[model samples]
Target: MFIREITHWFARRSFQNRIFLLILFTSTIVMLAITWYLTDITKERLHYQVGQRALIQAMQISAMPELVEAVEAHDLPRIKALIDPMRSFSDATYITVGNEKGQRLYHVNPNEIGKYMEGGDSDDALYNAKSYVSVRKGSLGSSLRGKSPIQDSTGKVIGIVSVGYTLEQLESWLNLQISSLLFPMALLLLVLLYCARRFSLHIKKQMLNMEPQQLSQLLIQQSVLFESVFEGLIAIDSQHRITAINQTARRLLNLSQPESELIGYAIHHIVLPEAFFYDAPQKNKKDEIVTFNQMKVIASRMAVIIDNQPQGWVISFRNKDDINTLSLQLSQVRQYADNLRAVQHEHRNLISTIAGLLFLKRYDNALALIQQQSESHQKVLDFISHNFRDHHLAGLLIGKYYRAKELGLELIFDPSSFVEHLPSSLSHNEWISIVGNLLDNAYNTTLLNREGSRQIECLINSEGNEVIIEVADQGCGIDENIRQHIFERGVTTHNNGDHGIGLWLVHSYVKQANGDIIVDNNNPFGTIFTLYIPFTREE
Candidate 1:
């Protein structure tokens, strides 16, 4: 239960705090263990050295010829004179000389000279003639002493010599040794703790100061946002390997593999244009038309940068067909509005003429003028409504007719023009873009030739196995140098920046439908654009 509580408390701390505390705890334990081990070793070595010193002192004093002679003759004054000076110069706590019967002969304290030695440990030295060290309770206190037996020339044990250090003195020396190491050990421990703290903080900064739980939550949020977006999104690493791909991207690219299977694969495997990957532009490229998996897409690219370094790239794209559909709808609405405005303006002029005629009492001329205007409008409307089955295509033609008239150009539809239905191979929007762009180009071209006939002719026929559309304008013909590349993007005969896209779009739609286009010089200074698109009937 106590362990569980400690774990819970530690788990609640921040990442840096947890790391610091763990390192500090481990370092402290190791330092303590080391200090304990060193202290034990130092104490043992000091004890061994002190014991040897005492033993050596006893052996030296026992071997002295003067002490031996004094002990053998039982000369107290001589033994006193010899041992007293040695005791005063020695570091031993006490020194004593005793007879074989355990009677004290000489001592550091004079009063104890006549009395027997206090400790009973002298039996080994007197009886066995042994030189050894022992710990015993003596008159002074518990002490560590070394004893040596003194023998005369006959090898008879006559007296014993003992040199000792008290336990209290040994303890004091040991404490002094331990204090010496403690200071440096503590300093090293403080340095270790400081380094651990610094390392922990560096780790925390690398994690952006966010906890594991927060990072996990952020990852989940990013995943949700990535998948929920409408545009197709793909992320590649610096090595050009796929790191992330959303469902929309898979669908747009017509990939059936799951995201897991797709990830880590080379980005080139999906066959996106090289512009998105190789030698990428520093600035973000947006709304670029690129081909992917044989399908046109409006794509955008942005490099992923972190810490002032390029990490990878993120690409977002949508199918071009989808965008084109929307553009076509808007264009149709605008054309409808323009057509209404043009028709209104034409009616106002006719009304003014009819009013003038009626005011002058020319009733016959006014009625004739009204009849002629009605017939002309009705003929064109009836022809378009009867021949064309697709309302959008017919409406586009009617709007273009009025638009051309407003621009002071005569737009004529061939009498034999007929379209039973739109081609099944191409979308309605694709057809609309082709026809509208061609008519608009023709109108613009015809208006440019002020010295020539301002007439634009259009023919659309879908009776055969393929659909045919032709738009010829009486304008300055294509330049000899540019005629081969006339349908290419950014190639325009007009002096305006926006003049190039219309013909390019027309050519793209034609190519997409497996159609062929021909550009030729029309008679008497003009240009003709003809398109033939193959059609298949849907069962």
Candidate 2:
């Protein structure tokens, strides 16, 4: 339990602190171990070297004939004179001359000259007449000692000569060796710690100083959010490779492979319309509307920047169904508002007329005029409500009636125009555009004529999933030169600063509905436009 606690405590430390501690601990252990090992080895080697010199010194003293004769005569003073000078000159810690009976004859300490010698190497040198070297403890502490036997001319042993050096001398030399190594080892430890600190700092910067567990949690959250979004999103790297693609993006792109394998592949290989991603990232990002997989979608792009440098890009898109639905709602609201404004203007004019008649004291005439106007407006409303059961179509025709009357022009629905049912395939907006633009164009052209003839006629009929519409205006007929391309974009007879997209939009809608449109410019009075739109509803 205690060991585990220590490990846990160390793991919780900051990266730099942990690294420093580890490096220092390891380096200290290694250098100390090496120093201890080398110190012991040097001590043993020095002891052996000093022992060799001691043996040589003992041999030189034993070779003197004067020392052998003096030992044979039991002359202590002569022996001491012979050995004392050798001890001082050879730097030996102790020198002793002893007889073969194990009794000391001469010593550095003169009081022990007659003492009995005690030690295994001393016995081997004196009695057995052999020379040897060994380590032993004496009165002056531990020492490396070398011993040799002195003999007469017949090779008989007389006495022994022993030379010794204390272990304290070896210890002093070992201290000097350690002193030389300490500085270099300290420098090496400092270098190791510095390198470890630098390495830890680099890793911290790369990871933004966040814990590993925190980074893992953040990645999991981002992944969940990416897949949960309804809109499609994709990320591209600087090399134009697809780095990431969400589920919605894969589905929109019509990809069959797994997202993992799709990464690192060039985006151009996946998206068929390669022009969509040709432009690099710019400061001002814009939303682009494009067609993908036969579906209309709005795409938006943004650059991923770091330190004011471009790294990659992220693109997101949403399908156009939502935008179109909102646009339809807004157009309906605007149409209703226009209808109300026209009605308001007409009512104001009527109120003024009635006020003028009353102010002139013509009460009977004002009442009659109000009744007549009421009856006329009711008749027009009743006719529209009765003929068209579809509220949208009826509302549009009624609104146009007021608009036409306001312009001093007469607008009428043909008696033969009958639609018992409206199909679902033709949307309300499409119907409004087709009928509304045609009527508007007719009204504008008829109003241009000052020949005292300003009139328009509208016919609407449906038969077996097909809708037929015909609008005619008593204005100057279309010119033959521009009639061929009249339904094309940027083609208009008005010659005003307009985009001339009304007829083009009409033609485009008819084509999208698989319908047809024809122009009858051969009319003696004005021009006529007829449209046929077909739709199918499954049973």
Candidate 3:
């Protein structure tokens, strides 16, 4: 089964699965974003904490009376001893005592025994802190500093005592805070994850318990909405095995026993000519009526494609008759479409001509020609188009010829002298109407006769005082049960989308000409329709 099958099988679900999915999506994103935010915030807080502790430690070291006296009296060894006990980080190489003027009072290293530390410069970190507070990256990006003013026995401030350390202390402090924070965040994440899994399982169960018929109904409803769809719908497994075939699929694929156990049969095995999957969305494919096994069918497939894998498909079918009628009607409508397109093309040319005339300042000639030749002429053309004799046979074949070609069915009509000369013996419009309807019906039947090869034969021969027009096809002939009723207004053997108008119209129009029409299944495998009209006897 595929994702679509899972969805379709449980279409009437309570949306539990979707809700769990939403929760999982939102929770994960929130967790990651918040973790990043808190981590950065904690790192900054830990950095500041390290700085504050260094200040306190420096104050304590500087408060030593011996160290303070050492700074004032410029005692180097005393200052080094006082700083040594306080120093911990090895990166803090040496310690120095500097005065209020940033002049070095004492240095643990002999090279700085009497060096004057520049007040604003960083030659001495602790001395600079007395006047200005800062953390600066040194020769090796590290600095922790503080300044403490020293006093003499008279309690007068004279020099500043300072100490310096490297940044390892700050790293230790940050890591401690980070390690402490991890435990709680991990707990929160685990709890949410546990909740998500539980919710997902519950939702999945609810979705699994849902019904599929509801989804099927919705699909049928959608079918009732669109027009001119050509694909034969085949709902099948990825192996092309049939599951549920629709009416269109039945006709297209010879799914005669619709209720039979067609569930596991390969679709290619069912229909003579196979239909293939199209890239259009499972729901958005063009619905065309195609012939299979010489039967007319509207076939389309709803393949369950997930992760680019085909699992199954939903095959839907409607009768070929509906499609045939629709195709015919669509062709009929095209008559007006061409005329409209022609008018637009003519209008464009007229506009261009008018623009050119105006540019040449032939204003009077342009206006008069526009009114008399363009606008007035357009109205006359429109009237002629409205009353134009559109193809008399346009409605007859319903363009079923193209469909016949697709099914490899042979459909031929005798384009004899009578086709063009029928007007001489019959009413021109009536001839168009009758010949077109009969031929169209022939083409349809020939395409659908799945039992054997199909062909059409037409012979318009004059016998005695009247002319004869016969339209015939070698097809799976009409059933004996429906033969008598074939000429009735609503008694059609096959019902898909047709209003059962073809034979009925043929009967009516032939009767109006005092002509007789008959259908005979003389062949072992197909049907033949013969039409006879009285010759217009010249008085």
- Order of candidate numbers by lDDT, starting with the best: 1, 2, 3
Lowest-lDDT window of 10 residues in candidate 1?
273-282
The CA lDDT of each predicted structure is 0.88, 0.81, 0.59
Task: Give TM-scores for every candidate, taking all chains together and pairing residue i with residue i.
Answer: 0.57, 0.48, 0.32
RMSD of each: 9.2, 13.4, 26.1
lDDT of 1 by residue, 1-539 (tens): 99999999999999999999999999999998998999899888988889899999999999999999998889999998998899889888998898888899987777887798887899999999999999899888988899999998888999999999998999999999999998899899989999999999898887878987888999999999999999999998878889999999999888999999999999988756565566554567666666788888878789987777778889999999889878977987888798998888788899999999999999999999999999999999999999988898998888888888788888899998999987776778778888999988887787788777988999999999889999999988899999888877778999988788888778777776778999988888689999999886561
Judged by whole-model lDDT over C-alpha atoms, candidate 1 comes out at 0.88
Candidate 2 stretches greater than 4 Å from native: 1-12, 53-75, 89-91, 123-133, 148-159, 229-539
Scored against the true structure, residue 230 in model 1 reaches a CA lDDT of 94
lDDT of 2 by residue, 305-422 (tens): 8668777888788876776698679868877887888888899999999999999999999999999999999998998898787888889899899988888788888987777766
Worst 10 residues of 2 by lDDT: 280-289
- TM-score quality measure for candidate 3: 0.32
Q: Top lDDT: which candidate number?
A: 1
Sort order, TM-score high to low: 1, 2, 3
